[model samples]
Target chain A: MMNSPICSMLDIEFPLLAFSHCRDVVAAVSKAGGMGVFGAVNLSPERLREELDWIDAHADGKPYGVDLIVPNKFAGKGEKLDTGRLIDSIPQEHKDFASGILAEHDIATDELDRTRGISGNFARNLRAEGAASSLEVAFEYPIKLIANALGVPPQVMLDLGKQHGVPVAALVGAKEHAVAQVNAGVDILVVAGGEAGGHCGDVSTMVLIPEVARALKEVGADTPILAAGGITTGEQMAAAIAMGAAGAWCGSVWLTTAEAETNPVVKEKMLAASSRDTVRSRSRTGKPSRQLRSPWTDAWEGEDAPEPLPMPLQSMVSEPALRQIDKLSQSGHQGAKDLATYWVGQGVGLMNQPLSSGQVVQQFKEEFAEAFERLSASLGD
Target chain B: MMNSPICSMLDIEFPLLAFSHCRDVVAAVSKAGGMGVFGAVNLSPERLREELDWIDAHADGKPYGVDLIVPNKFAGKGEKLDTGRLIDSIPQEHKDFASGILAEHDIATDELDRTRGISGNFARNLRAEGAASSLEVAFEYPIKLIANALGVPPQVMLDLGKQHGVPVAALVGAKEHAVAQVNAGVDILVVAGGEAGGHCGDVSTMVLIPEVARALKEVGADTPILAAGGITTGEQMAAAIAMGAAGAWCGSVWLTTAEAETNPVVKEKMLAASSRDTVRSRSRTGKPSRQLRSPWTDAWEGEDAPEPLPMPLQSMVSEPALRQIDKLSQSGHQGAKDLATYWVGQGVGLMNQPLSSGQVVQQFKEEFAEAFERLSASLGD
Candidate 1:
C-alpha cells in the first residue's frame, strides 16, 4: 500500500477518510482499507454506543473514527437552556413559517416527530457537556481518531483524545482558522472549502488546501491536513495529496452509497442532480450549509422570506419539517417529492450512479493510482 | 523549462497563463517564461491596437494572448445602443443612489468624469461588432490565443480564431457550460471557480476543473483546460495541473504586481487583506463580480439601497463614483480612502507584498517545483 504520514499515524491502508452517518457504510469503508468515520452528531450517547458496538463487530478490526459537532457557538450556548425552554425560545413566526410550508405541500406537521424522541436533549448534546457523553462512549470503543466540525474542538475533547491515545481533528474553512486549530493543539486539520456539503465558508477547496498547508508550514506547524469539499473521485483525492494534503476527507459522496441510510427520494435526486442543483443557504442550520436546492430552499430565498435563524434554532425549525417531508416523499407524495432536498456538494452532478460503499472505496484506490500515474507521466524525464 | 501540452500548444516555456489588464505586467510575465494574456474588455479598438503594438514590441519574442469579455448576455447585447442612449437609460434613482454615496463621504460628485473618456464607446465595444473590431486589431499582432469570458465565443470569433490559427478559449463555471463551449468548437476551456476575481459562478475551482475535465473526457472531447480562479501562486498552479488541467489561468495575482496599473490605494488594501476580504457583489458590474469590500460595497448591501442596475447601467452609475474615489484616494483623501475598492479574488490574502512581475513568475516556478517534489515524496515505493 502507498504510504502517507496520515496513513501511518492512523494505521490505515489508504489515507482516505470516509465521513458517513450509516454504520454499514462506515464499517464497509474501513473494511475496504479507508478509515470510516461515523458522524455521531444526531445520536444520543446510548444510541452512539450501540452504533459503535455494531461497527466494532463488523469492521473486521480495521481502524475507524468518530466525528462529533461541538460548535463554538449556537443558540443558548454556554447558557444551559433546556429543550423546553429552547423550543419556547423559537419565535412562533418561524414555527408558523415552517408549518405553513409543510401545509402547502400537503404534508401533516403533527405526524412529524418534533422532539425526535430526545425531547430536550438536542441543545444539551450540542453543548460541551453533551459532546463529552458522546466522546466518552466513543472512547469506550477501539476508535483511532475523533474529529470535530463547525469550530475548534474544545480543550476537553483534545485532552480526552490524548488520554485515550486517539488523534483529534478539527475542520477549518480558512488559513487563519487552521492556525487557530494548530494553536489549540489539533492533531489533524480537515480544510473544507465552500463547495463542501453541510456547513462551509466561502473559500473554495482548491485554494484553501494550499493556503492552509502553506500557512501551517510557515508557522512551523507540521499538522497533517485532509482536504475536503466538493471532492467525489480518486482524481480529486490525488489532486489534494499533490497540493500538500495528507489525504482527502470526503462526506457527500457516501450519501449515494448503497449502504448509506440517505432518504431514498433524496438519494435519487442526488443521483439525477447536476452540480448546479446545490445551493449554500442558511435555511437548514442557520449557518450557511450547502444542500440540494428544492422548492423549500427557493421559498426561503424569496424576497419576502425572513432570514434564517441562527444554528440550533434553524435546525429546530427545519429538521421536523424536513423529516416529515422525507417520510412523505418516500411514500410517493408528489408535493413532498418536489420539495425534497438534502446536504450535498456541487460534485453531486458527477455522482450519477449508485455504488456499494466498498465499491466506492475500491474505485477510489484505482482512480487515485491512475491520477498519480498521470501526474508522474507529466513530469518528463 | 516545464513542458506540458498547453505549453506546447501555446508555444510557451511553461503552462502558466497570467491574465492582467496592464500591458507592462503582461509583457513581463511573457518574458518570464509564461504566457501573459492582456484583458482588453475596457479598451477601445484603437487603444487596444496601441496596447498590442507595445506588447508586440516589448515581449521579446515570447507568445502572449488577449482576453475580451464578449458575454453571451449583457445590456443592449444584440441591439446597437449608442453610448448616449445606454447612459440615458440609467434610472434617476440609481444615479441618485450613487451620488448620495459619494455625498455621504464628502466627495464632490459633480467633479467626476461621467463620460470616462470612452463616452458611448463603452457600450459599443462590448457588442459583437465592437468585439470584432478589437479582434481585428488583436490578430494584427502575433497573438497565439484569444479568450472570451461570460459565455462561449460567438461563431464569428471562433471562425476568426481558426482563420488566424489562434486557439479560442472560453471561461466556464460549470460542466454543462464546458460541454456547451466544446460543442461551440472552442479550442481550450478556462474553468473558473467562484473564488475567482471579476465575474464568476457558484461552482468553486477545486470542483469545477475536475468536473469539466471529467465531463469533457466522458463526451470524448479532448479539449485542453486552463484552470483558473483565486489562483495566486506556483503551488496553486501545480495543483491545477495535477487535477488534469493543462495549465493555470490566473488573473488577480497580477493586480499586486509592481508593473500593474491597479489603483495605489486598492493595491495597499490587497496587500493587507485576507482571503475573506473579498465579496461577490453585482453592485460593480451588474453581474456578481468579486471585489475588495469597502464602505461602497457595504452601502449597496444596505437595506434601503436600491438593487444595482443591470450590467452597463450599473457600470455607468458606479464607474463615475469609483473613478472619482480612486483619484481622490490616490491623493490622500481620508473619506475616499475608506470607500475605494477594486476587483480582486479571495487569493488577495496571500498577496502580502508587491513584487515585480518577473519575481512573481520566478516564485511560482520554485513553489511549483517544491510542491511537485512533495507529492512525489508522498508516493512511497
Candidate 2:
C-alpha cells in the first residue's frame, strides 16, 4: 500500500515519483500507480504546453507533475539576452573545444551551431524570469506538483504554487540545502545524493537522508523527503523509506525502460557497463553531473581539456554536440556511437533489462512486497 | 533479535559490527549486544597481543574480531625493509610538505620524525610479509572473525582462517571486488562505500549493497555482506539490511561515543560538523579515504599541493604529522586544533552526543524497532 503522506498529498497510489524528460514516460508512469514528473528544462513554453497536453490525454485520469530549472543563482541570471546573443556570448575556445571533440570523432559539427539557437532559448528559460512563462503554461494544465532543481525554488515559483494550491518541491543534495528549501516554504524535498543522474552534490543518499531528516526535526519542519539517487529496485525504495525518506524519487531507472526516449546506443552501453563507467564531470553543464562515460567525457576529463564554462553556456556547448552525436550514432556512424553518452546514475548496473514503464512500476510493487517479506522473516525470528 | 546469517556465524545477538581502533571500544561493544571488530592497522604485534589480552579479559564472553590491512598489492609488499629502512625510503619533499603544514599551524613538527619510526613499522606491516607476525599474534587469541582491507584477503590469511576455523572477511568498495572476494573464498564481505571512514571506494553504500548482492548472486556466492558507509542510525542499518546487506558495519558513529579514544578537540569538531565536512581524498592514505575537512586536508587538496605518494608511502608521510597535530591540539594549540582532522565518514553529522558504547547499542535496538514500525505503517495499509 505504501501509504506515505506524499502519496496522499499527491493523490497517488504509490509514493514513487518518476522524473523523465519524455512525455510518454511521464504519462505511462503516472498511469501506473506512481506519479511521473516531466522534466521541462529544455522544453520551451510552447513545447511544455504541447508535452503537458499530450500527457493529459495519455495519463488516464492520473496525477502528474512538472519539473523546471529555476535556480536561485546561475550565470547571466539578471541579464535579458535573446537566443542569438546568449549563443554569441559563449567563449570561442569553448565552442571550438566542443566542435573539436566531435571533429576528432569524425562526426558533423554543422548542426551544433544550429542546435545552440534552439537549446539556447531553453537555457535562457532556466532563470525565474524565463521559466515564468513556462510555469504559467504548466499551471494552465492539471499538474499535481511543481519542482525546481539546482537550488531552492524561486519566490515566483513558490508564490505561483501557493496561488494554484499545488505543492512545490525542490531537489537538494545536502542537508543544509534541504533545510533552506523547507524554510523557503517548499512542500517536498527531493533529497538527492551524489549518485543521482543529472546535477548532484558530493554526499551520498544514505548519509544525506538521515542528515536531512534530523535537520528537519531540529528546525521543527515536517517536510516530507523523497530520496533520490541510485535507487533502481523496489528493495532500494523500501530502504529509502526506512531511512526517513517518505518515498523514493527515481530517474535513471526509467531511462533504460521501453517507454524512455533514451538514445539506443547509450542505453546499450548502460546495459553492458559496470557502475564504474559513469563519471561525474562538469563538462556538460558546468556543474557536476553523473553521466555515462565515453570518449567525449574522457576527453573533457583529460589533462589537456579546457575548463568547462559556467552553467547555461556549458549546456549550450554540449547539448548541440551531443544531439548530433545521437543522430549520427542512430544512423550507423561507428565514431558517433563510440562517443555517445547520456545522463544516468550508478544504478545503471542494475537496469539490465528493458521493461515498459508499467512493468517497471509493477516490479517495484512486487519487489517491494518481497523485500518486506524478507525483512519480516529476519525480524520475526 | 537482530539475528541473521552473520549473527549466527559470528555468534552475536545483533549483526551490527562496530569498527574501532581502541581496545576499550572493542571490549565495550562486544560486552554489549553488538560485536566490535578492532582496527589493527598501526598496532604492532606485541601491542595487538596486549590489546587482545585486555579485550579477552573484559569482553564478558562476547564475540569480537580483528581487522588488518593485508593488501593483495602494495608499494613494499615483498620488500624486506625494517622500520628504519622503511622510514628512510619516504620522499623528502612529501615529508617536508606534511611537516611544513604542521609548522604553518604554529604546531611543533619535532615529534613527527620520531612518530614516523613507529608508524613506519605499521605502514610496512600492511603487506602480507610484514603482517604475518601480527596475524599470528591475533590467532593466539580467541577471536571469532579475521578481516583484511585495501584488497582481497591475502592467500596466507585465507589459508590460516581455513586452518583455524575462523571466518575470513574482506572489505570491498565495488561489485567486482565483492565477486573477487567471494571467489577468493572470503566468508564475509564488508562492503564499505566511499562514504565510509578510512580506506574506501567511490561507490556509496546505498548503491554498492544491492550491486554487490546482485553480483554475488550472479556468481552463485552466498557470502554475508556487512554494509559500511554513512550508517550511523538503526534506520540506516535496517535500510542497509533491506537493500540486501546482512547488517550494518559502522565506524564513524562510534568516534563521538564516550568510550572512543578520539582526540578530544577532534571529537568536538566532529560533533559540530555537517555531513559535508568530510572530504574524500588520498592525502592521508595512498588510496582514497573519507576524513573530516580541516586546514590539513584543505592544503593537500589545494592547487599547489603535491601529488600524494602511493599506499604505504603516503601513510608514512601523513600519519606522523597528523599524530603530532592531535597532540598539539589536545594541549590547546588553537592553530593545531584548526588544522586537526581524522578519518570519519559523512555520518558524523548524526553523532552529536557523547553516549556510552552500551547506550549506543541499546539505542540502535530501539531505533531498529522504531524504523521497522515506520516501514510497517507505510506498508501496512
Candidate 3:
C-alpha cells in the first residue's frame, strides 16, 4: 500500500528506494517505479553528465536522485593540505607495508606502476567544488532529489536543491546527527545503520530506524526518514515502513544485480556470498565500510602490518594496491583473488540470486504487498 | 582501577567476567584474577560435574560462575516430546534439503545417520529440561555467580543462587531488557550487544552499554553491569568502565587462546580473521549467533535450500550436517573446509596471534592500564 508518507511524497508504487553507484541500476530501478539514487562520488564531471543524460533519456520521466559523499569530519578547516600534498605526506612505512603484503602474496610488484595517480572514490581535493559540479550536472537533467552520503548536506547544496525545487537529503548514522541535518534544512533523512555498506556508524537498522524517525518527530521536524542498511528483500522494506520510516534505502542488493558495474571476479564472490560473508573493515576506504572479507583485508589485520592510516590517507595508500588486486583477480590469479575485496553490506547473505535491478524492484514490490497482507491476516487470526 | 564496589560485591578482582562454555578458559580467566562464567548449555550432569570439579580444583579458590542458555522462548510448554517423536516430526523436505546440499558438496550423506542421536553444542530436547541437568550440576559447585545466557535467569536459578550466597545474572541485548532484568531480581546484568558471539540482539556496544548503565542508575537499580560482546582488549574494558559498566566480559578473545577447546581448524581461521570477518547467522542453534562465514552457511543461503528452520527446530535439522562438516574439515577435505564455520565475534580480527589463556588475560590487564593512562594524559593535554 502507498499509505506510507514517503511513498506518497515520492509518488512511488512502494516505499523502497535503491541507492547505487551504477547508472544502469539507477535507471532500471527508477524505470521499474521505485526511486533510484545514483552514487556520484567517483564519477568525473563528464562521466556524470553522460550518466544523467542517459537517465534523462530513458527514465520515462520517473523521479530519481543523486548521492554525494561529503562528511562533517573531512580534512577540516585548518591549514588544508591539497590532494598531491596529502598524498606525499602519507608515511613511507604505510606504503612499504602495503607493497610488502602484495609482494608476500607473490603478486607482481611491477603492476604497482599502473595504479599510480589513480583517483578512486571520494573527492580528494576541493570536494566542495566537485560537489557543486555534480549538483550542476544533476540539475541539468530532471533529477527529483539529491543526497549527501556521509553526513549533512552543505548549505550550498541545500540552497541549490531549494532553488531547483528538488528535495535535499542527508545520510546520517545517529539521531543527533539527524536532528542537525534537519536543522540545517535537509528535506529527507537517509538513516543508514552499521549493517549498511560503504561508510556507516555502529547501529543496527532494526533499532536505528525507529530511533531516528522518532527523534525527528520529537524535534518538530517532518523530514521523511528513509531507513538504509541491511534492507535486502521486500519483507525488510515492509518492516522498515512499519518501523516508522517513510521508505527503505538499499545499496548492496544492487551489486548482485545484472546491471551492477562490480568487478566480474569480485561479483562472482558476492554472488557466492551470504549476508554473513561481509565484514566492516577500514582496509578499503579507511572508514568502517562493510565489505567482503578477502585476504587483502586479512593481511592488514595482522599485528606486524602497520596500522591503517586515517580516512583519505589510508585510502590513498591502499588504492594502488587494490586496483592491482582487482586487475589480477580479473585475470584469474589465485593469489590476487585471495587478496581481492569489494564493499558490501550484511544484507549480502540474503542476496542469493542474481536479478536484474528492475526485477529486484518488482520482487520488492510484490513482497511488500504480500507482507502487508500477512500482517493484516494476523489480526483476524 | 579495581576499586569498583561491584568487583567486591561480586567477589572478583574486577567486575568483568567472561562467559564461555569451555572450562579451561573459565578457569584461566578466574586464575588471572577476573571472573569466568562457564556456559553449561551443552553439558550433561556427569560432564558438568567433571568441569566444575576441574574449575574448583584449578581456579585457585577464586570466584567463578556457570552460565546456562535458558532462552525465554522454547517449544512444547505443556508437555515434553520424546527424542524419537521430535526427530520424526522434522519435515522430510528439510532433511532432503540438507542431504542435497551435502551431496552437492561431496560430503558423505551417511554422516546423517539418525541412530547416532541429536548432536551439537546443546541438547536436542526443546524443553527447560534441556538445561536442567546442567543447572543442577552447577548448583553442586561453589560458584560465585550463576547466569542465564539467553534471557533472565529463571526464578529457580535466582533462588538457588541466593540460597548459595551467590549472585544471579542475566544477559540482555537491549537497554529496555536490562531494566526489565534488573526488576526481575537479577543481581548482575550481562549486557551483550550485536557484535558478540552466539545469540545477540541487534544493538552496537557503544550505544547499548551507556544506555543500559544509565537506565539502571536512573531507576536506582544496583545491578552490577558486565559489558560483554565485542570487548577484547583492556582499552575496551576501560571504555566500558568509563561508560559506567563495572567491567567488560569477553568470549571471542578466549576462542583463540591456547587453553581454549576451540575447534583447531576454526581457531586457525580466527587467528587470521578480523573484526569484520564474522556474521550474525541463525544457522547454528536456531537463533542469530555471530559466526564465521563458511561455504555451509553459503549453501543454506542458496535458492533451493529451505529457509533455515526456526530456533530449536532449525538447530535440530542442521547440527548433524554441521558436525559432519567439522569432522570432514579436520580431515582436510577442501569442500568441507569451505563449508566449516565457527562461532566468533568481531574481536577475532584484533587477535593477531594465539597466546596462552593466562597470557591473554595478562595482555588485557596491561592494555587496560595503558589505555587508562592514555585517557588520563589526554585529560591533562
Candidate 4:
C-alpha cells in the first residue's frame, strides 16, 4: 500500500519486489500483493521456459518478472570461446587452488564435472548474446518487469522491453552508472550499495539513492529508482523511500525463506551469520561480491592466494568446487560444511527467521505501516 | 521542527547534529537551532581550551559538544614513548615513501619536523592518557555533550560525565560495538558506517543504523543513536530516522562550509567529486578512513606500496608531508594542489555548494520537511 510511483508502474499493490531463484517464492510473493522477480541466470533456456510457465500459472496472473545476467563486459566476451576451450582457459593454478580448498575439507574433488546443472547455464548466460535465448522465453510470459543484474542492459533488451510494454531495470552501485543506465534507456534503476551480495561498487545506498535522485533531476530524467542492497525490512523500505527510492528490490531476504532454492547448508549459515560475518571478495564471482565469511572465502583473501581471474573464468573454478562442497556438506561432511559459504548481504543479521514467501510479504506490510507511523509521529512537535 | 528524541536530549530545535573541527561552525550551527559538536581530536589542550572559550562566548548560550579520539586500540599505547623516541620510532622506509609522494609532486621533502603545532599535540593525544588532559579542559567548560571517536570511552570519561551530569557519547561502526558502548555507560551512540569520513567499519549506514537499533533493543538498552556517515541533507536525515536512528550526526557536510577548517584546494576537489571518488584506505591512520581521492591517496593504494605502519607511526609519516602539501597547495603549487585531499564521506557528492554553517542547518530543516511531506503523501495512497 505504498504510494511510490513504482507500485503503479509495475501494477503491484506494494512497492516491494522479492528477487529469488525459486519459482515458488516468485509466484507466492506476486500472489501475496508484491511483485516477485525470478532470478534466471542459473537456469537453462529450457528450464527458464518451464519456470516462467510454472510461475505464470501459479502466480495467479499476478505480476511477476525475470532477472537475467547480461554483463556488458566479461572475460572472453570478444573471443567467443566455446564451452570446451572456455573450460580449458582456466589456469591450472586456479584449478588446484579451488580443488585444494575442497581437498582440505576432505571432500572428493575428483568428481567436479557433476555441476553441469549450473555451469552450462551460467556459461550460456555470461553475455547478452547467450542471454537473448532466455530473454525470448521471459518475453513470452505475461511479465511486468525484466532486470539485468550487471552493467547496463544491452540496446536489444531495452528495445524488446519497449516493444512488450515491460520495464527494463538495471542495477547500479554508483550515481554515474545510474546516469549512464538512464541514458541507455533503462526504465528503472536498482541503486544497490556496496553491502549488496552481488557485484557492487563502493558507494553505499544511503549516499547512492540521494546522489542518483539529484543527478537524475539535474539531467532531466524521470526514471524511477528501486533501492537494493542490505534492505530486508519494511522500515528500511520506508527509509529508502525517504531517501528518494521509489521502492525496495530485495534479493537476500528470500534466500532463507521456506520456499527458497538456497542450499540448505548455506541457508543455515546465513541464518546464523551476523552483519560482520560477511566479506566482499572477488574469489567467487571475479567481482567484489559479498558472501558469508567461511574457510573457503578466507583462504582466497589470504596473502598466498592468487588474484581471482575475471568473471566466467573465476566462476568456472569456483562454481564446481562450491557445488561439490554444497553437496558434500549436506551428506554429513563436516569439513565441507565448515568451508561452505554463499552470497549474502550485511542485512543477514535481520533475517534470522524462516517464513513463507507470502508471510514475508505480510510481515513487510505490517512493519511498513509501523515505520510510517513512527515517522509521522516524528513530524509532531 | 522534529520530535526525534535527540532533539529533546540535546535541547535543540532540530534533530540535526553538525560535527566540525571549526569552533565557528560549531557555534553557528548550535545557535541555528541544532547541536554543533566540536571535533577536538586535533586540538592541543591549550588550543582546546582556547577554542572552547571562544565557542562558549560566541555560541549565544546554545548547546554544543566536544569530541575526542581515544581509540580502544592503537600502536604504542602502553609503551609510553616520549617525544624524542616517538619521533624516532617512525620507520625511515615509511618516511621515504611519504616523502617520495610529495617529492614526485614537486613539493620539498626537506624540513619535515616543522609541524610541532599538530604533531606534538597529536603525539600526545595518541593515547587515552594524552586525551585525558584535553578531557579535563573540556570538563571545565559548560559543554552539553562529550564523545569519543575511536572506541568505547575509557572508564574515567564515563565517570567524569556522570560526575558532571554530562552525556558521554561513543562512535561505533558495528552493532556489537554499539551494544557494548551502551552497556559501558555511554548515554549516546554515534552509529557511523563505512561511508563515514574517518575510521569506520565496512557496514553501510543504511544497514548499520537499523542493525544497531535492533541490537540495542535486544540487549535491553535504551541508549539513543545518532546516525552518521554519508548523511548530508535533511532528507537523508529523515531516512536515517526512518531506519530507527534518533537523528542524523553529520561530519562531511561541514567540511566545505564557509566556516570549516578544510583547505581550499581539498574543499574544491570535494565539491567536484562524486560519491565514487573517495577511497577507504589504511594509508592515512593505519585504519580504514574515507578520504577524498587525490594523487596522494592513489599512490598509497598502488601496487608495490608498503603496508601502512600502525596508528601513530603512520600518522607521523602522513601528517608532516600532508601538512606541507596543504601549505604548498594554497601557495600556488600545481603538483601540491593535485595532491591535496582531506577526510570526507560519500555524502560529499551531495555537498556541492558552499554555505555557511547556519545556512546548512537551515537548509536541512527545509529539506527534511519536504521529505516528510513526500512520505506522508505516499501514505495517503
State chain A's TM-score for model 3: 0.93
Clashing pairs in 1: B83-B120
Model 1, residue B185: what's the lDDT?
96
The 10 consecutive residues of candidate 4 chain A with the worst lDDT sum are A114-123
TM-score of each: 0.96, 0.96, 0.55, 0.97
Q: Write the per-residue lDDT of candidate 4 for residues A1-381, one digit (tens) a residue.
A: 567688889998889998888999999999999999999998888999988989998998899999988877776675555767667777888888887878887888778872352366676787667788888889999999999988888778888999999999999888888899998899999989888887777888889898999999999999999999899888888888887888899999999999997888899989888888989999987889999999999999988788998867787788888887888888878998898888889889888888988988898888777777877788775
Q: For candidate 4, what is the total of clashing residue pairs?
A: 0
Off by over 4 Å in 4: A114-118, B114-118
- Give the C-alpha miss distance for residue B341 in model 2, angstroms: 0.4
lDDT by residue (A1-381, candidate 3, tens digit) is 355556666766666788988888888898898888888877877888888888877778888889876666644323344567777777888888888878888887665642243363245323677667777888887788888886678788888898998888888887778888899898888888787887787656644665576567678888888878777777566555655567788998899899998888888888776445667777766778877877777777775777666766787778888888888888888888888888887766557678999999888777665645533332221
| B244 Cα displacement, candidate 4 (Å) | 1.0
Candidate 2 lDDT over A154-243, as tens digits, reads 788899999999999999998888888888899999999998888889899988998898899999998999999988889988888877
Model 1 DockQ class: medium
Cα lDDT of model 1 by residue, A1-381, tens digit: 566889888998888999998999899999999999999888889899999999999999999999998877666788876667667777888888888888898877777655542335556667788989988899999999999986889888999999988999999998999999999999999999888999999888877888788789899999999999998888788778877899989999999999998999999999999888999999888989999999999988888677788767778788888877888899899989989999999888778889998999899888777776766666666
Which candidate number maximizes DockQ?
4
**Residue pairs that clash (backbone atoms under 3 angstroms), model 4:** none
* lDDT (tens digit, per residue) of candidate 3 on B1-381: 266655777677655677777888898888887888897766677778888999999999988888777766765443554557667777889888887777878887875765333443354323466566567778888888887876777777877878888888788887778888988898888888787877887656644665576568779987778888777666566655655567777888888888888778888888876555677877666678888867677666665666566656776678788788888889998777777778877666557688987887888777666544433332121
lDDT of 3: 0.73
Sort the predicted structures by DockQ, highest score first.
4, 2, 1, 3
- Residue B265, candidate 2: how far off, in angstroms? 0.8
